[model samples]
Every structure is written in structure tokens, then in C-alpha cells.
Target chain A: MAQKVAILGAGLTKFMRRAKETGKELAFEAARMALEEANMDISEIDCVVMATAPDMFDGVHMKGDWLSDGAGAKRKPYMRSYVGGGSGVFAIIHGWYLVASGLFDTCLVVAEEKMSSCMPHPQGAFNAIYDQFLERPLGVNLLWIFSLEMMRYMHVHKISLETIALVSVKNKRNGLDHPCTQKGIAGEYTVKDILNSEVIAYPVYRLMVSPVTDAAAAIVITSEHEAKRRTDNPIWIEGVGWCLDTSYWTNRDLYYPKYVEYAARMAYDMAGIKDPRKEIHVVEPYDPFAYKELHHLEGLLLADKGEAPKLLEKGFWDRDTKDGIPSCPSGGLLGVGNPIAAAGLMKVIEIYLQLKGEAGKRQVKREVKRGLAQAWGDLMQVGTVVILSK
Target chain B: MPFKEFIEKLSKAKVQKGDIPVWHLYTLGIGGDVFYKGLKEGKIKGAYCEYCNSVILPPRMYCEDCFEKIDKFVDVKGPFIVVAYTELYRDLDDNRLDIPIKVALISVPYAKGGIIHFLNPYQEIENGDIVKPVFNKKRVGSLKDIKYFELKK
Candidate 1:
């Protein structure tokens, strides 16, 4: 018997490339919003788990301790868990374990990242991911990884540049409906436009990737009994899984994401999903890069391997064009913005709101009985997956 | 303004200089012996875990789960797979590098880990394309050993 875990409320600060608020302030705003939505007070939280990407992003050292007060975790059990961009999804998993384990009845999970504070360049801190004694000396930049992946997805699946560009155009257009979208642009773009756009790396264009953003998001999780007493509708955590591959990123056949597939399999098994394509109604696969959506779609078992791009060509993944499933209903990181840790949880929040029928304008037309959210991080080797149901 | 006062100030200060301690360390922990040796051998080597059966470049000493030490090294014929990468426009000092260099997450088949490498400036390599490692044998044991990877015909 599993301990019942449910999301009581969720909140987020506006996603922005740069924010005027301090890290603590941004966290406080989101935490306050979650508490308000839950109709509960900060004093009610038994445990607090804060998730933030590198402290270097904010130019602050020992960020967990520095942000304890702002997250309302001064004296409570405080901890920070990070898996790079997957930290947001991992944070909710931590909160679920706390509530399910009966150690805490209510938990406050917060994730925030301020990429703007890095002095000189945020890309500099990103360089630290490479081998200090090996890869760092080769004069490597970041775009190389995405370009390679994009090329593989294209080569293996026979996906065209035009098909990939449609994803960026679609997500950005969908973002126009989102009030919190920071990079949302209302314009017409073609595959040629993306291909011709300044090549950041071979096979990757400037418009295909998400921009660095500063933002915060929060969610409150509680036991089944508490959720029943607090809200009319509570989104339950049906399953969760996180898996990491070797840090040696260059040694694997990345044409497919085995790590993501493994994580998704663990989640699907726990959720009692036989065929994800037939069972899951919505998806929010991580889209840090345009091709990643297609890469992760297969990893999520949302479609047969290498079949996602074909579906995309048929207008299958469009928010308005639901082909058995709706994906990135909230516009995703591609459109809503990528604030590192906050972005993944925002997808979680979207699932919660859609299930509760409170997603207002960004709401999907179909009933969202069960949904999946995933985030990838850590040298392209880590994948975190979650399944939720109402 | 008195010499006695100035002398007193100088006398109270404790100033000492010491040479910065240095140790020549082989980063055999993160990147395994195959990785270091490959740099020295002028060939790219990766390891495949027997248990999890995953390929790893910049070879790992142990499988992530079994924690079993891996000793076998295999050569990679690239077109490396790109997992996730970014491009930096400027250096740490906010100054541009001589040129925009391409860094990649190249995956070697039959290896448990991926080896990150630099792409030649004039060359264009796509994800999943075969590439060959270009090594500077003299720089082996140092980070600059594997100069860059070139697209394989």
C-alpha cells in the first residue's frame, strides 16, 4: 500500500530573463502564492525542500542556507536537491516522499534560479560542467551538444528542419496566450528562417533553443486526507521516477535517450500504464531544445520510437490540434521560458491546474484524467519523470 | 606625519609571502585510465559496462549501479551524438575567444560514458555523424592532449 500523496496548490512568479526581485524575494512570492492557493499558512508546513540550480547562477555561495528564511524553512527540516534542470521535477518527488512517508503531513517545495546574476557570463559557469582536466582545454562552447543531438534526431528519424522549426514557432505562438511568458514572440517563422538564422552550432540555430531566464515556482503537497479536507479537487501523484546515466556523455548512442526511457518505464509501471500512447491524455516533455521534444516524446513512450516527428508533421502535438494527446499545453520552456529549476515545476503546476479545470486560457480542450511531466539535465544524462492523476 | 608614527604602523603589520603549493595530479577519478591513456596514445578510447551494458566515453572506472570497475577500452568511430550543449559568445573576462569554438557531447558506441570534445573550426559535424579523434600526443596527461575531433568521411 502506498501512502497517498496529492498536490494541494501551486504557484509561480512570472518567468523573465531578468527580474528586479532578489532570489529570496522571488522565492517568497511564489511560496506566498502557493500558501494562498492552498488556503493555508506558512506555519502549517512541516518540512521545506528548496531546489535551485547552481549557486553560481545567482552569484551566491551556499544558496540553500541563504534562501532558508525566504522559503520559510528557518527551523524546519531544510534540504536542497539538484539534478540540474531536473531539479524542479526532483523537488516535487522529494515533497511526495515526505508526505507519503508520513514524516510530514504538509511540505512546501520551492525551486528558483536567477541566471542573470552570473558576472561576465552565465555560459562561463556552464563551462564548469566539462571535464576540468580534459574537455575544458579544447575550447568548447555549449551549442555543440545540442547541434549534435539535433542532427541525430534528424538523421535517425528523417525529421526535416522545417518540422523542427514548427515546434519553436508553435510553442512561441502558444506563449502569446500566457501572461507570464517572457520570450514569447508573435510572428511568422519558417524552417528556412530557422535554418538561415545565425548558426550557433552546426544543425542548431539561435531560435531553436530556450533563453536563460530568472524565475521561481512553488507547490504544496499533503497527505490524501489533508487534500480531501482542503480542496474540491486535488491532483494525486500516481508515480515518479528519476534515472541518471554515466557522466561520460560522449560514449553513448544518444540518437535515443535510454535514461529517459528507463525513467519513464519506471514511472509507467508504477502508474499501471500499459501503453502510454493510449492511456496518457497529456504530456509536458522537457523542451530545452526543439528536437528534444521529439527525442523525449519517444522516451516518454508517448509514441513509437522515431514516430514523434511524423506526428508533429500531422499537427499532432499542437495545443489546439490534439491528436489523441495534448503536449506542452502551457507552452513549455520553449515558449513560456526556461528558468532552469522553475521551468520543470511550472509543467507540474500546469498538470495540476488542468486537472482541476482551473487552467483558464491555457486550458486543454480534452479532459486531462492523467498527465506526464518530465525534465532532463546533467550533461545530457539525467531524466526525471512524473505521472499525475485526478 | 611623524616618522615615529609611520614606523609604529609598519611594525604592527604582519606580512608574509609563501609560494602557492602545486601538485601534478592525474584526474583519474572523474575520467578513467582509458580517457587519459587515449589522449596519450593519439586515439580516442571509451569503455562499455558489462553489467548495465551502457557505453561511456571519457570512460568511467565503475558502473553507475554495480560500482564494478571497468578496465576494457574500445575505440570510437565517431559521428558522436549530442545530448545537450550550449554556445558561449564571450569568455570569462567578457572578451571573445579567437573564434567561436564548437564543443560537443560525443557518444561512442559500446562505451558506458560519453566523451566531450572540441569540433574543428572549419569542419562541420552533425549529430550521429562519424568523427575521428585528433590528438596532440605531446600534450597527453594534460587537458590539451585531445586537440579536437574531425568529421570522418
Candidate 2:
């Protein structure tokens, strides 16, 4: 049997449009802060795992090798793992196996991105991720594909744009309390603001999308025995799961995220969760776009397909609502800024903090014992999930 | 399947060639900004790593050896030593050039890493020979500002 694993500490850098720090420096800052919070030193770590999105974004090849020293891996065992945007949450799953399998006692996981390095715009880097022979020939960017997904979802569910816009208003409002939220991205905004915002690709408004950002986030995880010896407030990693759908997204129905459902089912099975809607208290689902929150919520089985927007209108996903499950209380990618891989890890860190009662103003109203953080990416095919409990 | 049939089937498959239509605008990060700006001023600079007791060329924000933050940058006046040299008869696109271009990995004195730049075609160069950078008259904050390196008198 495998030993249990637990998160010891977490750290995050402020999300911004452009950062003066290089990718290495950003990784170092987050790693140093996480070590400090864990009351540990570089020498105490047994291994390190790094996660970052495409090399095109940073304009560097083999960026993981370049960032090894900054992540405190110096001479220790180190490796990089990636599944595009899903890398952040997947990093935690990777670290869990390192300690759970008794291969290492402690692991430091870091996710960083400098999307601003991709000149003109970071969206261009996303263009290169498409299928070369088929998708690339169509000259499709991220917004175009997401617009298709959003349109399909709304059409099948018969959801109004107003209901979808509410996700943007709620998440951005929730982000006002996040110290690391990107400037100008988070604040109180009305649904009308999101509806009237510049339409990048019909149905996908500017205000509804997460901004391009540069940032890093890190967490320290250890074997349950080591965690018990280190801190009294260790958050256990109850379950972890990930899945990837076929790369030919054109063949699939965009109305639902079956990949997320498959991943969530695997995790819920491992955690012995029979009823996610009632058992899971808080969730931080990937919400790079407003409609994605609802799309993912349905995929995670927290709501019936097309039922998430209805839950949102009832104030069920608000941060302060006692009778509701708070979603994206950390402002999510919509308000917190999306630096690809780091955005997913930020969600994991939020769940860790909320469980420990360390989330200053971002904590939910109801008592929470278990929470889930999920990330989706790679042509909208991959889903990574990590379940944490106090 | 027979060899002729397999070849015929393969020939019938369609192949498409395309390019990634994206341009990058990279920010010269913390240390790179200092190093590149110094080049524009007709100077060479390297970041000082106190723990490693060495200066690293192409200055970076952190020392790879000691893994410590590097905050000090010092001028590097060098009789650069040629570590290696290569002559290319073709350009990047594989087109024949009018004259072969000589490139060398030139190491600075007391610095950990070195810069690779064009070696003056007119000068006779060999490994371990001393050289110095000849700056461009109209300097830009780019690697191109260093026109080439010539043999030291």
C-alpha cells in the first residue's frame, strides 16, 4: 500500500501583464516563499518537479532545464512535467506519487510562466498548439475555438448570455479580496459590462476572458509522516486524477466536457466520494472564460449538464453564501490572471489555504473539510484534478 | 501487401506543409537588460556571483553554480581567448554565401561563460588565440552591436 501525502505549504507571486523578473527569477521567488512558509530549507527537499506551458510563450527551448536551479533542485533530483494548461494541477498529482510511493520523503512542485515574453500577443503562442494539417490551416486562435464551445454549450442548454455573464461578474467581484489578483482585471463589474465588452469572437467578450499574465506558484508536499512532524495544519491529498480526450476536438461534441467527467470520476472514486455536490464544500474549477466555469462544473458532476448557471443565479456559488457551494472564491483565472500552468497551481493553493483557514478574506462562509481544484487545457482535451481535505 | 502496392498507397497520401504564424517579442529580463544596455554603450559587463567568486558572462539574475541571487555587475575588459572556431560556407537557409563567415566561441577573462560571435574573416584565427570585440559604429542594444572580434595585436 502507498503512504499518504500532504501539502505542507504554498506560495504565489502577483499576477501581472508583464514582470521584470525572468522565468528563473520568478520560479525562485515562489520556491523561496514556499520554503519559508513550510519552515524548511532547500536541503530538506528530496526532489523537485516543475510545470510550465509551451516553450513558445517563454521564447526558450528546454525551459525546465534552465529553471532547475531557481526551483531549488540544484543537485537534487529534478524533472519537468506538462500537459499544457493542465500542468499546474497535474504537478500536485506528480508530487503525490513521489512521496506516496516512498520514492522520496519530500517534493517541491513549482509552476511558472512568462506569457508576456511572446511578443505582439501571447495568444499567438496558443495558435501554435493547434493541429498543423487541419486546425492550423483554418487560422484559428484560442478565442475562436472557445467561442465555438461556448456557443454549442449555450445552444444545447438554452442558456441566455445574461446567465453566462453572471460568472464573470461573480468571479471578478470575488477577486477584489485576492492580493495577487492582476491589476485592472479584477473589480466589481456588472453583467452588462461583460455583455457590452468588446466581442473578440462573437459570443466570447473581452471581459469574459482571463488576461495574459506572467507569474509563478509553488507548493511543498511530504509524506504523511513527515508532514505530521513538520506542521499541525497539514492538508491531506485525498485523491488525484487526470484524463485527456482525443486530439481531434472537431469530432467531439462541444456541449460537454467528457474529459473532465472522466477525470472527476476517477478522483471521486479514489476519495470514496459518492455525492460530489453534497460532499465537496468549495471548488476552484478552470475558468479562463466565463462559460467554462459552468461547463466544467457540469463535467465535474457537481451539477447536471446545463444546471450550473441556474445554481449561480441562486447565489449558490457566492463566497459568502452559507447554503451554497462557493466556486472560484480565489477569483479563479478570470479575475486572478492566467499564466497558463501557474493559474492551475494557484487554484490548488487556494483550496489548501481555505482548508487551513488561512485564506484571509477569501474564505467561504460555510465550514469546509474537503475541496477540489481542477484545470483543463490542451485543445480543451485534458483535465487534471486534486482533492484536498483538512 | 506487395512492395509495389505499398509504394503506390503511400504516394496517394496527401501531405501539407505549413508554418507557425506567430512572432515573439521577448523582454530582455532583469540581468539581460543590463548586459544589452551595456553593449549599446560600447562596454561588456558580467554579473558578479560572490558565493561562486566568479563573474558570469551574458549576465543572468541568478548564479547557476551557487543558486544565489546576483545583484552586482562589473565591467569585463578582455583579451578574449578563442575556445572554438567554425567556418560556415552557407547561410541559415542553406544558400551558398559569397564568402565564408568565421564564428568563434570567445571566452572572457575571469568569467564563467563566454559569447559566440563572428570572427573577423580577414584575420587568421586558431584555438587559444587572443581577440577583442570590434563594436559597430551605430550601436543598438542588441548582440549585433558587437560587429565582430579581431585578433589582438
Candidate 3:
């Protein structure tokens, strides 16, 4: 049988458009903060795992090796996990494997991104991620592809633009309490404002998109016994699951994220959670785009197909609402910032902090026992899930 | 015959050629800024790591060996050693060059790392040769500011 794994501490750097620190510096800061929080030194760590998005964004080839030193890998066993944007949540899952499988007693997982290094804009990096012979010739980018998914989702569910806009309103307002949230995005906005915002791609407004950012997040994981000995409130990593679908995204239905459902089901089964809507108190689903949060909520099986938007209208996903599952209470990527892989890991750290009762102003109204953080990436083909508990 | 038919069919398939038009605007970063600025001033600089008791060339904000923040900067006025060298006979497009260009990995004294740059074409270069950097008159804070390395006279 595998040993249990738990998170001892978490850390994050401020999210912004540009950072004076290099990618290594950002990784060092987050790793240092996490080690300090865990009351441990680099020597205590048995292994190190890093997660970062495309090399194009950081402008460094073999970025994992380049960032290993700052991530506290040094002379220790080191590994880099990549799943596009889902890499953040996958980093924790990778750490869980190291500790639970008895390969390592303790692991430090760090996720970093410096999207600003990509000149003009980071979106250019997404251009090459498509099928070279087929999709690249058409000049495909993330905005149009994600806009297609958002439109299909709304068309299938009969959701209004205003309903989708609520996610932006709520997440941005929720971000107001988060100290690391990006400026301008943390302010409150009305549905009218969002609807009236510049439409970069059809059905995708400027307000609906997560801003390009640079940041890093880190977490320390250890075996059950080690965790208990180290921290008074070690958040348990109850379950971890990830799934990847076909790279040929044109063959699949964009209206739903079947990959997320598969990943979440695997996690829920391992966590012994049969009813996520009730058992899971808080969620930080990937919200790089406003509609993606609702789309992922349904994929996680917390809501029925096409029902997440209706739930939002009832204030069911608000942070302070009674009898409702608070979603994106950390402001999410939509409000906080999207540094690709770092943003995904930030969501997992938010859940870890919330379960530990350390989330000062962003805590939900209900006391939580279990929470889920899910990230989706690739050509809309990968899903990663991590379920944490007090 | 069946295999031949498959081969004939594959030859007729359409091929689409394209390129990703992505560019980068990398920041000099914490240590890079200092090193590049020093290069513009016709000097070589490295970050000093007290724990490692050595200087890091191509300066970094943190020492990879010690995994600690390094903020100390020092001038490495060196008789650099030629650790490695290669002669390039082709351009990026694989066209034959009119004359072979010489490149060498030069290691500075008291530094853990080194820089790779062009060597003087007229010089008889060899491994373990001591060299000095030649800077351009109008210098920009870039690697191009250091024109090439030549034998120490």
C-alpha cells in the first residue's frame, strides 16, 4: 500500500505584467518562503519538482534545468513536470507520487512562469502549439480557439453573455482581498461593463481574459508521519488525478470538458468522495477565461451539464453565500493573474491555505473540510485535479 | 504490389509549410543587467558567491551550487583561457562559408562559468591559449559589444 502524503506549507509571489526578478529569482523567492513556512531547510528536502509553461515564454531552453537551482534542487533528485497550463496542479500530483511511493520522504514542488519575456505578447507562443501542418497554416491562436469553446458552451446551454459575465464580476471582486492579485483586474465591474468591454475574439471580451503575468508558487509535501511531526495543521493530500485527451481537438466536442470529468472522477474515487457538490466545500477551478470556470465546474461533476450558469445566477457560487459552494475565492486566474503554470499552482495553494484556516479575508462563509483545485490545458485536452482536506 | 500502391498514394499527399512568428524581448534580469552594463564599459563582470568562494561568469542573481542569493559584483579583469574552440564552416542556412569562423569558450580566472564568443580569425588559436577581449568603439550593453578574443600580446 502507498503511504499517505500531506502538504506542510505553501508560498506565492506577487502576480504582475512584468517583474524585475529573473525566472530563477522568482523561483528562489517562492521556494525560500515555502521552506520558511514549513520550518525546514533545503537539506531536509529529499527531492525537488518544478513546473513551468513553454520555454518560449521564459526565453530559455531547458528551463527546468535552468530553474532547478532556484527551486532548491541543487544536488538533490530533481524532476520537471509539464502539461501545458495544467502543470501547476500536476506538480503537486508529481510530488504526491514521490512521497507516497516511498521514493522520497519529503518533496518541494515549485511552479514558475515569466510570460513577459515573450516580446509583443505571450499569445504568440500558443501559435506554435497547434498542429503544424494543419492548424498552424491557418494562423491559429489561443483567443480564437478558446472563444470557439466558450461560444459552443453558451450555445449548447442557452447561457446568456450576462450569465457568463457574472464569473468575471465575482472573481474580480473576490480578488480585491487577495494581496497578490494583479492591479486593475482586482476592481469590481458590472455585467454591463464586461459586455461593453473590447471584444478581442467573438464571445471573448478583454475583461473575460486572464492577463498575461509573471509569478511563481511553491509547496512542500511530505509523508504522513513527517507531516504530522513538522506542522500542527498539515493539509492532507487526499487524492490526485490527471487525464489527457486526444491532441486532435477538432474531433472532440468543445461544449464540455470530458477530460476534466475523467480526472476529477479519478481524484474523487481515490478521496472516497461520492458527492462532490456536498463534500467539497470550496473549489478553485481554472478561470483563465471567465466561461472556463463554469465549464470546469460541470466537468468536475459539481454541477449538472449546462447547470453551472444557473447556479451562479442564484448566488450559489459566491464566497459568503449560505448553502453554496464558494468558487474562485482566491480571485482565480481571471482576477488574480495568469502566469500559465504558476497560475494553476496558485489555485492549489489557495485550497491548501483555505483548508488550514489561514486564508484571512478570502475564507468562505462555511467551514470547509475538503476542497478541490482543477486546472485544464493543452489543446483543451488535459485536466489535472488535486483534492485536499483538513 | 500493395505496398507500392501505398507508397504511390503517399507521394501525392499535400504538404503545408508554415512558421510560428514568435519573438522575444527578454529582460536583462538581476545579474544580467550588471554584466551587460559592465561589458558596455569595456569590462568583464561576475557575481561573487561568498559561500562557494568563487565568482559566477555570465552573472546570476543566485548561486546554483550554494542555492543562496548572490548580490556581490566584481570586475574579472582576466587573461581568459580557451577551454574549447570550434571552427564553423557553414551558415545557419547550411550554405558553405567563404571563410571558416572561429568560436571559443573562454574561461575567466576565479569564475565558475565562461562565455562563448568569436575568436580572432587571423590568430593561431588552440586549447589552453590565454586570450584578451577586444571591445567595439561604440558599445551597446550586449554581447556584441565584445568584438572577439585575441591572443594576449
Candidate 4:
């Protein structure tokens, strides 16, 4: 059996639409914060694993080597891994192995994205992701696929625009409590407001989307003995799971994410959790879009298939609910700006802080022990999951 | 704080610049030849997986879910439904669009995927609206062969 691993520290930078810092600078900032919080020096990190999505975003190739120094991995054993947006949680999984295998006493994991570096519009960089010969000629941007998925999801679930809009309202409201909340609007907005917002795509309004951002986040994980020696409080990694569906997204049903379910099952099994709805206390599932929270909630099996929209109507996934659970109390990518990989890493950081009772104003009202964080990326292909317990 | 002097000194540092200047040419793979040829003939070719008894739009060589090789080609039965639509307020440069291009996701009935393209009509386009492909008089084996999908009059 692999050795147990624990998170010594976590760090996050406030998400921004644009940052003066380069990718390396952002990585260094987050890494420095994490190391400082752990009361550990950069020299102690035995290895480093960096996660960032798309070279296009940073306008750099061989991003791992370029970012290594800023991530505090200068002349240290280092590598990078990516599964598109899923890289955040996937990096955690990679770091866990480094410590769990006893090959390294500690590992520093960081995920950064700088979408602003891509010229014209960051959305244009996504053109390379499409089928060069077929889908490329359609003049499709990233939002078109999301709109297509939203339309299909609504059609299959018989979902209403009102219920979907509520997700935006509640999440943005939750954002007010999170220090990292980056939704640009200064005041409160309602479902009616969301309904009246500019319709970028039918069934998807401007309010429903997560803004592109430039940001970074980092975490330090150590072996059990090292964790005990390093800090009085160490959040335990109970389980980790990742799964990837074929990239041919057009061949799969858009209404449900079977891949996330597959990943959730693996993590839950490792955690010895047979019932996620009852066993899990908090969630920070990827929510780059408002409806995505519902979609991923179902994928996590927190709600029944097509049942999230109805339950959301009853405030089931609020930060504290008499009948249900708290989710994305950190504001999630819906309210927090999305810098792709950093957004996902921030979700993990949220869970860690919540479990540590250091979440400040965004802390859930209910007592929490175990929490789950997940990320989805690619053509809805990659699903990465991590379980943390206090 | 002498920041101005520091800035001037930093600006004098040598800088190096380079560009890849590479272009990519991608083949549509096994299933693409038939599909593009059909496009030139003003027909939308869809892949039929006999094993799954289903058809996929924008055709592929295999069924991603079932992992079955798809060798059969079929014309997507139309009166395509406008499953979704969007109006773009900004272009690639993030500038507000002058005429606000209308794009629609049109699907052949019961197909798993659909084609995303510009729509001819600017207003009153709703989900479930029946649409027909409008082909150009001059044929080219490309997506532009069909100018746009128009609501069937």
C-alpha cells in the first residue's frame, strides 16, 4: 500500500482579468505563499509538479521548464503534467504519488494560467482546439460548444431557464463572502437580472459564464511523518481519482458526464465512501459556467441525474442546508474568475481551507469533516477528483 | 524611490525575439474524404455505425462511445431543427459587432451531434425552428459550400 500524504499548505492569488505578472511571476507568488504558510523553505521541496493549460495562453512553449524557476523548482527535480483544465487536480494526484511512493518527502504542486497574454481575444486561442478541417471553418469560438452543450442539456432534462439562472444568482451572492470572488459587478444581481442579461448564446447569457482570467495557485504536500513534524494541522488526502473520455465529444451525449461519475466512483471507493450525498460535507466542483455546477453536481452523484435543477430550486446545495449540503462556498469559478488551471487549483485550495476551518467568511455553517473538489476540462473529456478530510 | 532611473536602466537591457512561423495542414482522416465530397455535392454526410444503430453528424471514422469502426455514410435526414442559437456582440478582436452575427446549432433529427454555422435570419429564430441548408451555386469541398441555414419558408 502507498504511504499516506498530507497537505502542508495551500496558496492562491486573487484572480484577475489581466495581471501585470508573467506566468512565471504568478507561479512564484503562489508558490512562495504556500511555502511560507507551511513554515517550510523552498529548498525542502524534494520535487515539483506544475500544471497549466495551453501554451497559447502564456504565449510560451515548453511551459514546464519555463515556469519551473518561478515555481521554486530551480535546479530541482521537476516535471509538468496536463489534461487541459483538469490539470489542477491532476497535479495534486501527481504530487501525492511523489510523496506516497516514498521517493520524495515533499512536493510542490502549482497550476497557473495567463489567458490575457493571448492576443486579439483569448477566446481566439481556442481555435486550435477544433478540428482543423471541419469545425475550424465554421468560425466557432469556445462559447459555441458550451452553448451547444447547454441547449442539449436543457432539451434533455426539460430544464428551465429560471432554475439555471438561479445558479448564477446564488453563486454570485456567495461570491460576496469569498475574498477571492472576482465577479466584476459591484452590486447584487437577481435571476431576473440574469434573464435580462445579454444573450451571448440562446440558453446561455453573459451572466452564466465564468470570465477569462490570469491567475495562479499552489499547494505543498508531504509524507505523513513530514506532515506531522511540519504543522499542527494537516488536511489528509483521503482519495484521488481521474478519468478521461475520448476527445470526440460529438460522439458522446452532452446532457450527462459519465466520465465524472467514473472518476468520482474511483475516488469514493478509495475513500471507502459508498454514499457521497451523506458522506461528503462540502464541494468545490468546477463551475466555469453556472449550469455546469448543476451538471457536475449530478456527475459527482450528489444529486440524481437531471435532479439537480429541481433540487437547486429548493436551495439544496446552499452553504448550509437543513436537508442537503454546502457547495462552492468559495464562490467557485462562476463568481471567481476562471484562469483555467488556476481556477481548478483554487477549488482544491477552497476545500483545504474549509476543512482546516480557515475559510473565514466563506466557511460553511455546518460542521464539515470530509470535502470533495473536482475539475472538468478538454472537450468535456477529463474529470479529476480529490477527497480531503480534516 | 529612484524608480524612473531604474526603469530607464532596465529598458536598456538587450532583448531577443523569435517566431515559429509554422503552418499546419491537417487531413480530415479516413471519414473526412467522403464527408467533404458530399458537401461539394450539397449534401450533409453523416457517419452510420451499424453496431450502434446510430448516426453521427460532421461524420467520424469511429463511434467514440461504443468504439466501433464506422464505415458507412448516410445523408443526415433534414428539416434540421435549430436546437440552439447565439448572437455575437463581439468579434475575434473583442470589438462590438456592427450587425451582430447570428449563429445556430442545427441538428438532424435524432443525431448525437450537429453543425454549428451562421444563420440567414437575424430575428425570430427559436429552438425547434425548421431549417434547410442553402448551398452555393459554385461547388467547393469546404464548409462554406453552404452559405447558411435558412428557416424553411
Candidate whose lDDT is highest: 3
Model 1 lDDT tens row, B72-128: 656765656554334556778889877777887777554455766677767766666
Docking class of 4: incorrect
Give per-residue CA lDDT, model 1, range A1-390, as digits (tens). 668999988889898877766676677778878888888887788889998887666656788778766677867898897898899998998888888898889999998887777756666667667665567667666677778878977888788888888888777766776777885442356767677777788677788888888788999999998988988778999999989999888898878999999999998999899988878888889988888988999888887888888888787787766556778878888788888889989988888887887888878887679989999888988899989998
- DockQ category of candidate 3: medium
TM-score of chain A of each: 0.97, 0.99, 0.99, 0.98
DockQ for candidate 2, C-alpha atoms: 0.48
Write model 3 residue lDDT over A1-390, tens digit each, in one string: 789999988889999899988898899989988988898888899999999989888668899999998899988899999999999999999999999999999999999999998867899888878899877777678788899999999999999999999999999999999999877878889999999999999899999999999999999999989988977778999988999999989899899999999999999999999899999999999999999999999999999999999999999999998899999999999889999889999999999989988899998989899999999998899999999999
| Candidate order (TM-score) | 3, 2, 4, 1
Task: Please count the clashing residue pairs in each candidate, in the order shown.
Answer: 29, 1, 0, 0
Judge candidate 2 at residue B23 and give its lDDT: 64
Candidates' TM-scores? 0.71, 0.92, 0.94, 0.71
Error of 3 at A70 (Å): 3.1
Model 2 has a clash total of 1
Candidate 4 residue A143 C-alpha distance from true site, Å: 0.8
Q: Write the per-residue lDDT of candidate 3 for residues B1-153, one digit (tens) a residue.
A: 355554458778877878656788778789889989999999989899998799888888888777678889998888799999999999999999987899999997668999999999888999999999999999989999999999997
Docking class of 2: acceptable
**Taking the tens digit of each residue's C-alpha lDDT, what string does model 2 give over B6-92?**
446877898989875556676778888998999999998889999879989878888766656789998889878999999999999
Residue A177 displacement in candidate 4 (angstroms): 1.8
